[model samples]
Target: MADQITGGCKCGKVRYAGTPLDAAPFRCHCRDCQQLTGSGHTEMMPLAREGFAISETCRIYEMQGGSGQSTYSGFCPDCGAQLIRRSARMGDRVYVHAGSLDDPAQYAPERSIYSDAAQPWDAGSIIKAD
Candidate 1:
């Protein structure tokens, strides 16, 4: 992982910086992730919530997650760029959308979640879960 992870919204209205958590990055193929990203999956990098900080307030959308807990999606109000994902099940960490990273190339997803929900077109891209 990078020394310090940094990213922002598409409009640069909501920037974020944090220390990367020790968790493995993952690709999620859940329906909610598909809809939120408008793609087959969402690549996420976990960050320790203790030091995570966002430059501006983000518009958050809350919904029930697969774990039967509240999950929040944070986005840029101006550009509607999805930047963060947080779930009550994992309060100590926040997931940052890999696409939102300033250096997206640094993102390396090690596993896939909800792979059973993966669409046919994207099924081949699923990385085996560790």
Candidate 2:
């Protein structure tokens, strides 16, 4: 784990790793994220898609965004926890949820993307996404 990132599903299935959370992390307030997480925002860390390594089998689901971007969200089929997500807009970055990690400090979000859709009840200070 010192050389790379490591985390897994709640049920201990669907593990993954990548470059250390050296890559800047951010929070996403996009509607897609709020809807996907059923929360105010998504604490995601963007990393190289190729750098991501999977251990257990995961469920890959595809969805087309209103922006005409295609995305494949990968998660644990058993626990139904999202581990990583990929899209056309982000060629190499795999926006991962910070909560998924054992120690989420490395993925601390520096900003939030798409604040226009953010819930009024959410009072986070991170920069909202455009």
Candidate 3:
């Protein structure tokens, strides 16, 4: 992976950069992710909070995750693009929305989470059928 990764939101607002690729990207299929994204799953890469920097204003939404811990979701104030998420499950780390990356293809997810809450069509295909 590249030494540095950078990206921003849809409207040129809420730009950010993360370094060192702290953790492998993963796909989340939890109902909260599905409902918030209106998609089957959401992809994210965990990085140290200190290594991440944002350039614009963001709206943060805090909610309780399935683990009963706080999950902070951030979005671009202008275009409503999802930017990042910080979960108590991973302290000192924040998960950046993979889709927000300039080259998201590099952050392929190696695992899937919250499979029990995945939709029927998505359940059987959480990971590729290798």
**Residue range 4-81, candidate 1, lDDT tens digits:** 899999888899999999999999999999999899999999999998998757888999999899999999999999
Global Cα lDDT for candidate 2:
0.75
Best by TM-score: 1
> How high is the CA lDDT of each candidate model?
0.93, 0.75, 0.83
Backbone N/Cα/C clashes per model: 0, 4, 0
- How far off is residue 55 in model 1, in Å? 2.7
Model 3 segments beyond 4 Å from truth?
128-130
Among all windows of 10 consecutive residues in model 2, the one with the lowest summed lDDT is: 121-130
The parts of candidate 2 lying over 4 Å away from their true place are 20-23, 128-130
Better of 1 and 3 by lDDT: 1
Question: Tens digits of per-residue lDDT for model 2 on 1-130?
Answer: 2466777789988888877545668777777777777888778877667767886488888899657999878889898888877888767777777888867776666676677777888855557444
- TM per candidate comes to 0.95, 0.86, 0.90
**Residue 106 displacement in candidate 2 (angstroms):** 1.3
